[model samples]
Target: MRLALVTGASRGIGRATALKLAQQGYRVAVNYRKRAQEAQQVVAAIREQGGDAFAVQADIADEAQVMALFQRLDEEDKPLGVLVNNAGILFTQCRVEDLSAERLQRVFATNVTGAFLCCREAVKRMATQHGGLGGAIINVSSAASRLGAPGEYVDYAASKGAMDALTKGLSLEVAAQGIRVNSVRPGFIYTEMHADGGEPGRVDRVAAMAGAIPMGRGGEAEEIAEAIVWLASEAASYVTGTFIDAAGGR
Candidate 1:
């Protein structure tokens, strides 16, 4: 079976992606930093579907833990075929001037540095230059990167912008080596992440703005997951260094 690893697979977009990939027949490695129970629940759900899955704990922001995550995979001796850098965080809405250095550091540490580190490892394993089979990487970015997310979390937007750059740059760097890199930018998805932004009902509060979107509604995690899975699948074999804006016509 092809092996796929998804970071922050405990919930939200990550969870949905994990389950979908499992259904698509990839033996999944569900990565979570904490939320062990939730991660295990995802594994259980995948297994219940007659799919192979295991949970691995790692703070992708921490280099050591990320290394350990790969170490565990090495011990299992599975050749990775797909990677979903879906782990990210969003702080409470605030202006750029109101944000502190620590907050910026924390946000970039996970959103930017974390994704970078994971991509580095995946490239080493999946790149033909490294004597391994080819694979695909799908970075979970945000439409906020394009909208600028003014007055909200510019830092988060900036971080995702960096992810977009990484997707393009890395796709070029590894295209000849059989690795495809892409991104999916989701907008106003109904996930608990808004609660982390200090408003559990933020999406509902912002629903009035849906008129600006051609679709006139917030998206769902599953919708984003479908795009992600397709990008990771062979149907997208000739696709690379591009992105799917799963945002509702934002």
Candidate 2:
């Protein structure tokens, strides 16, 4: 069976994507930093639907942890066919001047370095040059990358901007090797991530700040999951090095 790894799969977009990919016929490895029980719940839900899934714990920000995560998957003897670099974090509301170096480093550690490390391990297992079958990588970026996220989260925005660059560069680097890399930028999604930013109802509180999304509302995790699943599917066979913005037309 095909295998797919989704970071931060315990909740939010990651959870939704894991479920959707399972529906797409991929045996999922649900990776989470904490919330082991939540991750197990996701695995159980997939299995209940007659799909295969397993939960793995790892803090994507740590190189050693990332290696260990893949090592466990390697033991399974199944070739990885998909990777979703969806694990990320955001600090409370603050301006650049008020942000400290430590905060910046922490944000980039998980949002940027973490994704890079996961991609490196995945390429080793999926690249044809490494004697493995080719696969696809779907990055979970944010509209903040383009919007700059001004007062709220410039650090998070910058991290996503780097992710965007990685998507394009990696896509070209492995195109001939049969790997496709793409990203999805989700706008104001109704996820717990908002609470992580120090506001439980942040999206609802600021949805109008986008001027006006053509769809007239914030997106759902399932909506973004559809794009992620599509990018990992054969339907996107000829598509690579591109991105889909699920930001309600903002």
lDDT of 1 by residue, 122-148 (tens): 999999989989999999999999999
* Candidate 2 backbone collisions, by pair: none
Please, what are the lDDT tens digits per residue for candidate 2 over residues 46-163? Answer: 9999999999999999999999999999988689999999999999989999999999999999999999999999999899999989999999999999999999899999999999
Root-mean-square deviation per candidate: 0.9, 1.0
Clash pairs for candidate 1:
none
Where does candidate 1 have its weakest 10-residue lDDT segment?
204-213
lDDT, residue 197, candidate 1:
89
